[model samples]
Target chain A: MATALENANLLSRAILTTQKLRISVSKTFNHMKDGIKVSQDEHGAPKSFASQLQEDLFLINESFIELEKLTMAVRRQREAETIGNTGALSMDPVTDKTPLYPKALETYKWATRLREHSAHSQAFLNNSSIKRSSGSGGSPAKRRKTAPTNLNISTQAVDNLVMNVNRQFHDVKITKIQLNPTVLQVYVSRTLQAIIVLRGLLIERVLIRAHHENTLNDDGTLDLWTASKYEVFQKITEHATAASLRYYLPTMQDLSFRSFMHWLNSFSKLFSTPCRLCGKYIKDNLPPTWRCFRTVEPYHECCRP
Target chain B: MGVTCVTQWPVTENRTVPQAVEVLTKRLDALGASKSGNFGVDCETYQSVPTNVPLKYIHVMHNKEQPYTCYAVTDNRTCLVCENSFEAIMHRLNGFYVPKKTARIESKGTRYEMGDFIIKIGIVSLGPHARGVLVEVEYTPCVIIQDCWPLMVEFMQGFMGAQYTPNTHPMLANKQEVPFNAEDTVFQYLEQFENFVKRGSSTATVR
Candidate 1:
């Protein structure tokens, strides 16, 4: 029932309105985040969120408004053209200064341009604005929207690297002299090895955390330290230790069996003394009193003693 | 050069999603420009931030087996410390705490700048009570800190992730003075440089 002219006007107005909204939102986000230079250095210019938002809204709105005016003008002008009435619209009272036709044409052109711009603003909103990212990164681009849902690796590549390195460089046993776990007076030589020893502490903790998963989550994922990064961590330790050896090397004594044992002892003692047979005392010197007679009964003597 | 500080993070920062959203939201609101019907952001509204990086997460441009170098100048000589020189300092930098320098560059201008494991400056810190501390003959970090501090904090918060806030406090209302009054120890640094030359390296085995 509506005329062709009415349909065209309606479509143009809709497009114009959408474009204006997009610009406004983009401006607002920028102001709240940083400024014009959301990621600029000090002494940099300020980007007002409120003002920018207004401008964006204004620009888009201006465009849409333009589109609406243009559509109206086109409709009126077209009507006049159809009737051979050039002065017909001139007399109609939409405002003599801005003939409905001319205003509509200008609005339509700008509104279309502004609306076209809406695609980009939407992208920036969707993407995390990788444009300002550091490095020799190129222009603002939409990195395909990816959920951080990376494949849950069974073995964190980093941890595997760490374990591999630790086992490779550190697992070796010194030739003859065994380390005395009870004593703290072992001579450590390689500075690199010392770091290995330190890093091993962290890895050991990770191992324990892995060991602690008594139950699985309802989702089927286990509560273990299964991040793919564990292997990488291991590799890093390996690399660091290898690198450090240039400056300092661990001595035979430093790598003595005793140090390894001491580390083991510490690892096993994460909670408390290892399964004490007594009521509470965890000392190796304690007489076993969990049940029967208690007279110098270090039952688990092979390991504890 | 002996490195007193080191971080494996390489001074680089990473970009995560929600963080991006937060930034975009803020920036867009300030711009007040949006598509007519869109929730937020128009196609043309995205602009890159200037130095949006926090010095903390900003990774070094390059990678090396050795850490970045820091140099200190004494009255008589200049002392330097590279990344690999110290283990503890490196761990701290990369692990949790990122050191921030505070102080003023009195009217004289700074005698030193953080350049290539070498910081050349006549004065390090102005006397404790001095309203404006002096770093070089005059340059100061504080004068600029007032404006840039917030940006740095924001960047750090975003870049550091879990390590940014309550877990890792980036905001330092009051940064402490250096280990030794940089201005007071011309003799020590000068002497240490000499000792380092004699010994081939200046690695003080700190207890």
Candidate 2:
């Protein structure tokens, strides 16, 4: 009677542990589904995605180990009962009357399947590569050797590029170019104004406002953050940002900058240019807001796609 | 505030004041202008009391577009753009400048917005009598009149008929290169108000 009670307790404990393992496994899967972002915990400290995932996995491993131990004990108890009853009867009365043995076997099979699935998931996760840092993979000495030759153009090079572009394009005027986190203000004809921000040699941000709209704040400094008040110019700003990405070339910074300026010069006819597709000056009460990057033809937002 | 052009929409032989406004609104609706709301611009004439100082008229004006500012244009054409608190200062100067009760005139009607343009069709009135219809168009993006005048004219011609050529407002003639502001807008309204007063109840001939 005591042994039977012990078996029942072990079975219930195994079932509870299995439920915990299933929950933790699903939790890990859910976390993986949503691309991991560094989040803050209740204490306001930044908790990393990898650490959270590791903790969940650890809980699942503990539950699996406990369950395996319980299943082994249950199997040993069944074996002992069968061996003791071999001489007394052909088959155990309790085993025949109840479906306990079959149920135990089925539970064991289910646990085995869960274990296999979890192992496969673990292997897949281990093989998947995620970029976690900005630094290139190398030792400190090797990194130091490569860092000096990085693709960061000097201020003089940027200035020379700007001067050359200004000379090439009559309408494209680079009014101001400031260094130490480079900023360039280019006035394109009387149509629009553009402000370009650079990180090292790369163009990081671009803002476009109308010619009449003050690109300066009340204090007479270049306004980098405020969006254009007019919707037409706002749409142009979006297009210019895309152009910056299209013209990006790390190896040849000067050529990339010139290409971007050339693309922007197309907008000198922003107010006058009619839509190429619809062949109308105004659609949906807005003048053609889109300009093709390659062809420089104007199209209304709806007419573009 | 961008460059604004305020002109009288003449009340012709066939159309009355409200009828002319209706025609204009219909034309604007057809041109894809959605009615935004109603706007009113009222001007109160104040004359300095006959003292040692010369008698000068100060037109204290309020435009619904610029709710927080008061525009006071002196007879010399110099405009003082100040906070709404200037109304209290005007009240305090009651002994110096006396308000002309009968000269209180306003232009009030529907306002419409089409893309970058704001169109206001207002009925000018003095006391209880309707005076005329004044149409004001504002290109809200471009501040320089010279830069956007052609564009404004093209847009205005769409609804005002192809033959309706708008001469630049007299107030904006010298301000073509200057950045237009709320003062410029209100000064134009004041000019139209003075015209209505001089003409009395006679309908303005379309120019």
Candidate 3:
């Protein structure tokens, strides 16, 4: 704790010194314009200040490294304490010798390759003038209808792989599926609508936004995350996850969903009750009826009654 | 930080401004909505003189709810919802902006509150002539338009009846996830006020 405090103090002092050095460097530049020759070696003070700035910058870098080490140490300690408490609920380590199910591995590989296809398509788009001839006022309906089938062979293959993976979990149903050359939008059961867009072969960015039965748009697509909608989803999911830990395990940095069903199964935890409003541990009880249409917080029928 | 719905109530045959408001307020009160106070929103329009700067209107709107802020949209399509010092900033740009068409279309009526829902029924006026009614319904707890629209519509229906059916507001289109704020609410009212101005003289229409 004392070392952490010392590291923090050093970080702040280093930052302040860097700021002061920056001001002096700016002042020195101004002095150079005011007819003061920079090569004034007799006084040598201005040159010393420039050198001092370089030294200050080096100190700041060192302090930042020290600060990062201190923070990571604290985080590791907290994580260890948590793991100790939740002994049975430890995350599945990726290096487990047991090979993943053949279908699941194939699906994962296909999804991973989507990132590369998206990049290649993007490069093709950039190099080609095909979009300019398409006209600016091209409607969305037309865009969907005219989407070239030849370009989406990889997309269809991945879609089939994803659908097959979801078929493994009995209750997890995928209601709608739309595939573009670079993006896939999937409506999973009733709880979540996920849009997976590829960044590269390494990055399959999955944006799972909230979906509602009544609020479905004319296009039959869910509204993407806005700041407010994301907050509402986050709050409800967090509250639900806190109430029950069995279904929704915490996500790590890698964020690789095992299968479509694996991701869909987590949404069931959002409806887990003992009612977030009443805060009673009602075992084997019926799910709360009335959920806040926006936040999706479940409440007892009697509470909202 | 909340979703707000703004719609105009076109005054029709046999119904006076006060009578329409009273009827609506009473219906709201009956439905457990309590009166908070009176509320008003106003806008001032200015144009830059041609000799010094470009010819365009600089609209600045002030809302009673957000007293400290001013929503100023310039001719260049730049919008700034800034502090009370916005007037001083305008004054500094004297060569650029000169008052052209300043219409102080205001809504003066009672504010009502019920749980997370806030309803304001105002008799909008231009000078002495009562133009129409402006009803603003807000769901304070929720920011997503998709989440709050139903509740707002339900609340408005209780008082407004069949006349004020909520439509897809053009300003709110493509703004599903964007958390509606005070600036947006004022902009919607300004839009309605602009439409009223475009419709020519309110007294002429009434006559």
The CA lDDT at A248 in model 1 is: 25
Worst 10 residues of 2 chain A by lDDT: A82-91
lDDT (CA) per prediction: 0.31, 0.81, 0.58
Every prediction: chain A TM-score: 0.18, 0.53, 0.28
Computed on C-alpha atoms, the DockQ of candidate 3 is 0.02
TM-score quality measure for candidate 3: 0.43
- Per-residue CA lDDT of model 1 for A75-180, tens digit only, reads 3333434324453654567556667755655676789899889977887776664332222143324222211222222333434543443454343221211111
- TM-scores for all predictions: 0.15, 0.62, 0.43
CAPRI-wise, candidate 1 is incorrect
Q: Which portions of model 1 show Cα errors greater than 4 Å?
A: A1-163, A166-210, A218-221, A224-305, B1-207
Ranking by TM-score: 2, 3, 1
DockQ of each: 0.01, 0.24, 0.02
lDDT of 1 at B167: 18
User: Which candidate has the highest lDDT of all?
Assistant: 2
List the candidate 2 regions with Cα displacement exceeding 4 Å: A1-150, A166-181, A189-191, A199-202, A211-226, A245-251, A266-269, A272-283, A288-305, B48-55, B91-96, B201-207
Clashing pairs in 2: none
Q: How do the residues B1-207 of candidate 3 rate in per-residue lDDT, one tens digit apiece?
A: 456888977676899888777777778867777789888887778777888644678788888898888889765446788888888888788887866643667887889877546788888877667778888987554445654454456556666885668777654575545655676787778778877777756646888
Task: Give Cα distance to truth, residue A222, candidate 2, Å.
Answer: 8.8
Give lDDT: candidate 3, residue A55: 55
